[model samples]
Target chain A: TQLLEQSPQFLSIQEGENLTVYCNSSSVFSSLQWYRQEPGEGPVLLVTVVTGGEVKKLKRLTFQFGDARKDSSLHITAAQTGDTGLYLCAVPASGGSYIPTFGRGTSLIVHP
Target chain B: DAGITQSPRHKVTETGTPVTLRCHQTENHRYMYWYRQDPGHGLRLIHYSYGVKDTDKGEVSDGYSVSRSKTEDFLLTLESATSSQTSVYFCAISARDRVRNEQFFGPGTRLTVL
Candidate 1:
């Protein structure tokens, strides 16, 4: 099974601080996706990185895919309480499967 | 947001009872998926359908079954509910776009089995 390991399982930061989360895997993926899920709701797609060493930014959030396609990172700048949620990284399963294998996820709490 | 909706947003049932969760989509995307989210496990795929009547199992498909008879609906049924089955269920849809494996997700359904 393809597994994605996420580091810093839990994160707590004060508003205006900056933090980064990492997702690493031993297997190569064609594409990688990042999602943020709030309590009592489903996850919302934040970004999709298809090429190695690709970077995408959404407001205060920056996402990067590794050059080996085996890892990714998410960086949040000037975090706010609204940024508190569970962040996940997922990769499509290999061989004719579109289903993705998800990381354990990082729970972020931004205190004001 | 994906034009997906899951019925029975919250449900509580006894063990051994049958439970079914419905996922409806308006986008008519060719791919539909069912996943469960728990405290430690972020999201695990239970089943997915590529097209009408064409479905496949995921890593954790032990006690769950899915059916997709039409383009807009997918149903997931728990043969016999167990306490371990309790979790938040999400339905997602994706298109054939190569660059974007990004799936649109529904609001989700919460289930608790006693």
Candidate 2:
């Protein structure tokens, strides 16, 4: 079974601070997806990175896929209270699998 | 908000009791999925249906069962609820577009099995 490991399970920072969270796995993947989930709601897709060494930016958030396709990272610049939420990384399973496996996720708490 | 809604936004039941959750969608999407969200476990798929009367088990499908009799409704049932089964459940619909393959989720139902 392929697994996605996320680092810094919990983070608490003040507004205007920048932080980075990571997702790593030993298995290679064709694509990876990022999601942000707030309290009492389902996760919302942030971005999907397909190519190796690919990077995508959305407003103040920047997401990058590793060159080996075994890892991904999410960086938040000048975070605000609205940035407080659980950040998750998900990847499609290999061998024609339709199920997308997800990481444990990194919970961020940005205080204003 | 792809026209998806889950019934009984919050439910409380006792162990050994039967529980059923409903997912209704108006988007007419072919693929509908049920997942459970827990701390440190993220979203784990319980079951998914690609078409009417066609369903498949997910990574964690031991104590759960699902049925999709119509295109717009998917049902998840727990024959005998257990304390460990308490968690927030979410229903999602996907267009299955090979390119983006993004899933739109509903508000989710919080089930507490005491």
lDDT measured at residue A64 in model 2 versus the true structure, 0 to 100:
97
lDDT by residue (B25-97, candidate 2, tens digit) is: 9999999999999886778899999899999999889999999999999999999999999999999888766
Model 1, runs deviating above 4 Å: none
Q: What TM-score fits each model?
A: 0.95, 0.93
TM match of model 2 to true structure: 0.93
Residue-by-residue lDDT tens digits, candidate 2, A1-112: 8899998999999999999999999998888889899988888889999999999999999999999988999999999999989898888645655567789999999998
For model 2, the stretches where C-alpha displacement exceeds 4 angstroms are: none
Clashing pairs in 2: none
- lDDT (CA) per prediction: 0.91, 0.90
DockQ each candidate and list the results.
Answer: 0.65, 0.55
The digit string of per-residue lDDT tens for model 1 on B8-109 reads 999999999999999999998999999998877778889999999999998789999999999999999999999999999999998847655778899999
Native contacts retained per candidate? 0.60, 0.49
